[model samples]
Target chain A: MNILVLLRMVPDVVEELEIAPDGRTLDTEYLRMIVNESDDHALEQALILKERKGGKVTVLALDAPDVDDVLFSAVAKGADRVMKIEGGDGGVTTRAAAGMFAEIIRNEKDLQPFDIVLTGVQAIDDLDALVAPILSHRLGLPYLAIVTKVTPDATGKSVTAIREFAGGVRGEFDVPLPAVLGIQAAEKPPRYVPVAKVRAAMKTSKIESIGVPTMADGGQPLLDVSHMRKPVVSGHAQMLDGEPEDVSKKLAGIFTERGLL
Target chain B: MSGNIWIVAEQWRGKLSEITFESLALGREVADGLGVKLQAVLLGHDVQNLSTSLGMADSVIYVDHTELADPGASAQASALAQLVRQQKPRTVIVPLTNVSLGTGTLLGEQVGAPVVNFCKDLRAADGHIVADCVLYGGKIEATVTPRGDLTVIGLWPGSRPPDKGRSDRNPPVETQTVTFADQPSVKLRSYIEPDASDVDITQQDVLVAVGRGIQSQENVALAEELAASLGGAVCGSRPVIDQGWLPLSRQVGKSGLNVKPKLYLALGISGAPEHLEGMKDAPLIVAVNSDPDAPIFNVAHYGVVADAMDMIPTLKETVLALRG
Candidate 1:
C-alpha cells in the first residue's frame, strides 16, 4: 500500500507575471513559487490513504526554488519520505518530465515497491495534463485522471477510484495495484500544517536528491514559445471608466438601455 | 512514418461526442498544412453508421469489437495502438477529455511517440508540427514540438467550432479489426450521476458568477445581492462550491453546469479554461477582478480592474437606483 505522490512548484498566479527579456518566458527575477494547488491535493490524498491504510507515503518533486520547503511541509503533513529530483528550472514540459520520472522510478532500486503513484491532474504552470498518463504508460501501469476519491480493497489487490467527468458525472473505477492516477481533489481540503510542525520537520528530516542528466535525451519537448503577448479581449466589451459609483451608474444605464430593468 | 493526419473519434454509448467533430476540425487544418489527407479512426461495436458522420475527413477507418462497446482505457489504447502501428500516421489527434487521455498517452508510449495534451493551436512548420499550449491556467503559453517521428496530440474541446460534414457525399470508409487482450488492470465499478438540480441556471437571462476572488462565504452575499438587483441568478466557480459557500448545483464549469446567458458577470473569477468553457459562448461578458492579468479579461467584453468587494455593492446600488 505504499504510495508515491508527485508534487510540483508553480509560479504563484496572484503575482503579476512579466515576460522575460527573452520575450518567450516569464521573468523569474521576482517570481514566487508555491506548490501547485492540485498537487497539494494529491499529496493530501496520499497522506489520507497512508493514515487509513497504515502505508508509507513518499513525495517526489522537481528541484525548484521553494521545493525543499514544499517537501518538508509534506513530511510535516505525514509524508514518510520526500525526494527532490535535480534539474528543470520549472520550464520543463510535461512529456519530458514524465520521461525523467519514469527513468527515475525504473532505475532507483529502493523506490520500486510503490503500489500506487498519484499526481495532480493538471498543473497550473503547464496545463498539459499528460505527465501521469505518460508516466503510467512508460511504466506499463493503468492510468486514470480527474480522480476525486481512492479506496483500497480489503484484499489489498485493487483500489477503487471515483473520477470526475464533465458535467458533474462521476465514474467509479476498480484499478489494480501498481496503478497511477491524476488526482483532481482530495476527499477533504489539504489539512493545515502549523509553522511549528514544519520547522520541526525541517530540522528532523533531510531531502534526498536524484540527479537527472537531461529530460530531453529521449523525450524532448517539441514546443517552444516564439513570442507571447497579452491576449486581446474579444467581443468588444465596453469598459466602464471612472470611480466605482460612476462606473456602476454607467453599467446600470447600459442595462436600462437593454431594457433588463 | 506516413504523411496522413489521423483523429481518433471518441464515442460514448453509440454516439460520437461533439469533441470528436471538433478534433476533426482541428485535424483538417493540420492535414491541409501538411498537404495530406485527414482520416478518422472510429473504434466501437457496430459503429458503421457513425463513420458517415465524419465527412470532414477524406476517409474513415472503423475497428469493430464487442468489448469496445464498453471500452476502458486499456482496451481503447490497445486497439488504437495496434491500428496506429500498422498505419503509421505522422500524427494522431484525440480529444483531451477524462476518457481519451489514457488512449492518447498509452498509444504514444506503445509506439514511442511523444504525447502532448490540451493543445490550443497546431501548425505544420518547416516539415515539423508545432503546437501552442497554455500554462499557469492560460497565463503563460509555450510552444512545443514533438521530438519523435510520430506524435499523438490531445485537443482541447471548444478550441474551434465543430466542422459541419459535407451534405453532398459521405467519406470513404475502411474497416479494420484489432484483437485486444483482456484488460484486467482496470474495471468499471459504477457511475455516480449527479441528480438534476431544482434550479437550472442555464435558463437564466443573466448570471453573476463568483470565484475565489470573492474572498469568503460572507462576501458571497454581496454577489447575491448584485445578482438579485440585476434580476439574475447567482452561480459560482468550483472554489466557492468547494468551500461550501454555494451548492454544487449552482457551480458552473466543465465539471459543473454549463450556462449561456445573455450576460455573464464574472466576479473575481480567474477564468480558468474550465470556467471559461462553460460561459465563453455567452453574448456579453463583464468581469471584475483585482488582477489585471487575469485570464477572464481576455474573454470579457467589458472588464474593470477593481475588487469585486467594492464593485458589487456599488453595482447593486446603481441597479437599485435604476429600478427606482
Candidate 2:
C-alpha cells in the first residue's frame, strides 16, 4: 500500500508575523519555517502504518528550496519520498487546495498503490478546516474531521475513527480503504527526523515539482490582510480573595451572572 | 424602527447562555449600523415563551420541540433553514461550539452563504457584512466580506463588545414556530456528558497559564497557589498537558479549547502557535516569561521580562492587597 501526506511549510508563529509589503500575504524574509503540526501526526501515522503493512509513505509539499530541508527531514522521520509542488506562493485557494492536492496523489509515479491519504483537521495557517472535505469531494473519497482516536484493522484495510463533535458529543466512523482523513493532532505526533539522517538523505533525495495549480478562475486572492496589530484589552485582572469556600461562592455568582453555569 | 437582526437563540434545560445574548447585542449594533432592526431566532422545546425574560432584542424566530434536546445537527440546520426562508436575515450569527458549526455549516451550504469561522471584528461593507479575523496564528488579519445573498459568521468567544448593543423591538406576544419538512438522519443515543470534573478552562473569565519554565512538576505548586490566590483556573501548554502534570481539560491550544478570557496572564510559558491559537483572543494578555524573546510577548499587553518565579509572589501580594 502507498500513503500520501500533504506537508505545508508555513512561517514560524514564534517571530512577529508580518505580511509582505505588497500586502497580498505572509512576508517570507526574516521568518523561520516549520512543517504544519498536524501533518507531522499524519506522517507519524503513515510511518506506523507502513511498519505494519510494508508500504511506502510519500509527503507532498507546495514549497521552495528552503522547504527541501523539511522534506528531507520528513524522510528521516519515516516517509519514503517527498514531492514538492513548485511555483511562487499563491498555490491554491482554501476551497480548491485539497482538490489540487488530491491530484498529486493520482499523478505521482509508482506511488499509485497508496491506500490512504491523511491531513490535519485544519492547517494552523488556514484554520478553515476545509481541506479534507474538499479533497474527499474531488477524489470521491470518504472523510472525517476532529478524529481523536483511530483503530486500523490488520486483517481489513479499513480504519475506525472517533471524532469529537459539539456539546462534547462523539461520533464513531468506520473509514474504508483509500479514504482521506484530517487527523486531529492527538491521533498521533509526527516524530522528528535525525539531523544525520536528513543530511545523508539530502545527498540522494530528488525534490521535484508537479507544477503549482491555481483556482480555475485564475485564482482570486481569497483574502487581503490590512493590519497585524495586537488588540487593546479593557479592564484590569480581577482577583478573588478568601478561603476555598468563599472563592467557590464568588465564582459561582460570577458564572451565574455570565450565564456559563 | 431598527431593521431586525435576528440571533437564533440556543437553549438547553430552560437556560439560555449570555453568549447568545452577547451576540444578540453585537447583532443589534450591526443592525443599527445598517439602519435595520435587531431580532433573535430562539429554538428549543417550549422556548418561544422565554424570549422577553431572556432579553428579547428585536423579533424572535422561535422553534419549540420536546426532542430538540437530542442535538442532531441536521435538525438544527433544517429549522434554521426554515427561519432563513421566513425572515431573510442579512446575517445569521452563531457560537463556535461544535453544535453550531455542524448545523451552521450545513445551513450555510443550503442557504448558499459563506460561514466565516471565529470572526474577531464585524462591520457592514459593500451592501453586505464583513469581518476582520485573527488568522494564521494571529499573525495576519483577514478582512473577509461574506459572499452570497445572506452571510453567516462564527463569532469568537470574546470579540464582541459587551455593552455596545441594544434594541427596543417589543417581543411580539407570540411568534411563529416553523417546522422542518425533512428531518435529521442521525438519531440521538442518550448523551453521556463528560464528568463535571472535566477541566473546564473555557468557563473561566480569568486564566493564569503556566509554561515550561516551571523546571519540575513539584514547582507546579506555585501555579496552584497562584490559581488559589487569584481564584482563576490553571491550564498548561501541550508539554504540560502531555506530561500528565495537568488533565487534558486544562490544556489550551488548537487541539484543546479555544478560550478568550478577560485577562490571561502567562507565567513562564513560551508562546508557540499551537498554544497561542488557544488563548490569542484573551483581551488582556500579560506575560511574565524570563526569556525576553518568548513568543508570548508578541500578543501580550504587558511584558514582564523578569522571572515569573519572582513575579508570582509580587502578583499575589498586589492582588491580595487590592482585594482588601
Candidate 1 lDDT over A1-261, as tens digits, reads 789998878889889778898877788899999988888889989989998999899888888889998999899999988999886555776767777888888788888788999998877655333678778767878778888889998989889998876666778988898999988888877889999999999999999988874544555555455665545445444566788998897777767776777
What is the C-alpha lDDT profile of model 2 across B142-213, one tens digit per residue? 666654557666665445544443334457544566665551133333444434677578888778898777
Least lDDT summed over 10 consecutive residues: which range in candidate 1 chain A?
A: A229-238
TM-score of chain A of each: 0.90, 0.78
Candidate 2: residue B187 Cα off by (Å): 9.2
lDDT of 2 by residue, A1-261 (tens): 677888776666656666677665567777777766666667777777787677788888876436888888877777788888777465354544554686666665576776778776665455332566556545655555656556676755677666655334456666677777766644444565678999988887777667866535343333334444443334223444554344445544553355433
TM-score of each: 0.92, 0.70
Which candidate leads in TM-score?
1
Q: Is the docking of candidate 2 incorrect, acceptable, medium or high quality?
A: incorrect
Report chain B TM per candidate. 0.92, 0.69
Task: Extract clashing residue pairs from model 1.
Answer: A124-B136, A222-B144, A222-B145, A223-B143, A223-B144, A223-B145, A224-B143, A237-B301
* Poorest 10 consecutive residues by lDDT, candidate 2 chain A: A228-237
